[model samples]
Target: MKIDTQGDTIRIYDFNAEECFRIARRLENQSLKLYQGIKAAIKDADIAAALDILIAEELCHLAYCEKALIDMGVDDINAEHLVEVVDTGVVTPLAQADIERVLCNRQEALKLGIALEKRAIAFYESILAETGNEQGRIALGNIIEQERGHRERLQALIS
Candidate 1:
């Protein structure tokens, strides 16, 4: 799949819950892959637990998006949500080393993840500004925060 879907990255400016759901679904898939890769690379129990938490957070975010779509009545409308996937090269298995030492491939993925989160946060922040209803604005604000949280977590992973 095309990872960095080009064209207005600011689509959330006019987005409803369905849009969020679509994007969240993509993020959920990407996060699953990321966590699985990290799990394979690390042997430590605590790091694995942290990765598990990250995966669950992504799932929860996806659920929130889906619920919003359902509530907005756009879940049935079927449109491409433009969720970008991570680069496939990052998934390659290696002999592996210190998780604290940094894996180059995972680092690349982390960089991309940060950029994606920035875009998502910007999108929702703009939407929150434009949203006519309180619920929509609140949802956008919350989603923006979630994306920001992910960005911070991913930043920590690479650093």
Candidate 2:
């Protein structure tokens, strides 16, 4: 699951529903890979166990993104008729190199987790702000809260 930071980080200020969900799914996949890689690198069982929970959460989120696309009948992203416009960029999770540089210990891993969750929350919030449909706004709100919970859990582990 190698992601090119430059290509994947292209900001799409105006995107339709299909594009939104596809980008979300892509971010979730990146997140899952990051957590899995970190879990593989860490020796401590306790930290690995925590990463397992985060990985599971990311999986659920990814599934939700897929289901959303299905429910919307979005067979393809045409990049036409956007829901709203805003200053939005691709939500980039920590790259492989960033993860490796930061994963010195359990504490550092937890810190990275916090940062990852923060990015997720920010991405959803930005989308939420620009979302015109009530359903989309509600869904984005729920996702933002879930990401916040992930951040709080990592913070508790660090404390």
Candidate 3:
């Protein structure tokens, strides 16, 4: 299912509630992996420490998505099935190849973190706009607020 953003409205094509939860969980897991990769690659103690915090945040986000799936009546969430869901085209701030370059310095790492948080906030807002389920909307709203807080913390770190 493709999620299209046309002006102010978001169009979710042929997605059921279960599929939506799967997509969300998949995206969160991808982000968690990205943060973990970056944290592993960074050598600077300070940058590594900062990334450690973001890694924890991403893990929490992933858990929240999983909980949302369970709340949607999905008893057993198969990770393989989640990976097969339609690609939502959620972009990470730094690609795998670019991770080394972007995370070379503290400032750059913080900038990447800020960009990632912004993208996550936008993605969740779009999903929230398209979701008809009240529970899903509430979950998305909470996630968005958390992403905003992450962005603000990254901004503070940079400044």
Candidate 4:
């Protein structure tokens, strides 16, 4: 399955329950890498520490995605397989300009974090819309709620 993103719209092609889980796992991993990259680029100790906490949260989100895959009967959760399943370029919400802003200002980093969480929420909501399975919808809904919470936390930081 593949996700095509154009401007603010996302089109999902040949998506299934298993692919949904795989996509979630891939996005979580991407977000984790983004946080780590931002942490490395910033010199402020306080901002770095805050990013560390976000990194830990992303780790937990990744674990949840892995478990969701396992529960969906995916026996193998290989990183290489996930990469082949979906290209990161299509799913990544942050662009080079956003990353540049994040590196220069802590407030910009928080805004970027909020934007990423909003994108994750939209992705999960899209999955929920595509899914016919009750369990899958419930799972995706839960993930959307979590992303909303993350967005709210980031919003608070910016405020």
Kindly report which residue stretches of model 1 are placed more than 4 angstroms away from their true locations once superposed.
1-13, 75-123, 126-138, 148-159
Output the number of the lDDT-best candidate.
4
RMSD of 2: 7.1
TM for candidate 1 is 0.51
Winning model by TM-score: 4
Q: What residue pairs clash in candidate 1, if any at all?
A: none
Candidate 2 Cα misplacement greater than 4 A, ranges: 1-11, 14-18, 73-98, 133-135
Mark the regions of model 4 whose C-alpha exceeds 4 Å error after superposition: 1-17, 71-73, 79-84, 88-93
TM-score of each: 0.51, 0.65, 0.73, 0.76
In model 3, residue pairs whose N, Cα or C atoms come closer than 3 Å (at least 3 residues apart or on different chains), thus clashing, are: none
What would the per-residue lDDT of candidate 1 be over residues 106-146, giving only the tens digit for each residue?
45445645654676676556546765665555666677777
lDDT of 2 by residue, 1-159 (tens): 111246558434333456566656677777788788778887877677777777887888788877887888776533433332322343353467767755555677677767878877787777666666665566666567767876887798789
Q: Rank the candidates by TM-score, best first.
A: 4, 3, 2, 1
Kindly give the stretch of ten consecutive residues in candidate 3 with the minimal lDDT sum. 79-88
Q: Please provide, for model 4 over 1-159, each residue's C-alpha lDDT reduced to its tens digit, 9 standing for 90 to 100.
A: 456799998766545656666767788788888899889888987677667767877787788878878877777778456434455452364578888877777777777777778777876776677676666666667677777877887788778
Model 1 C-alpha lDDT versus the unseen true structure: 0.57
TM-score of 4: 0.76
Report the lDDT tens digits of candidate 3 across residue range 51-82: 77777777776787678778777777874663
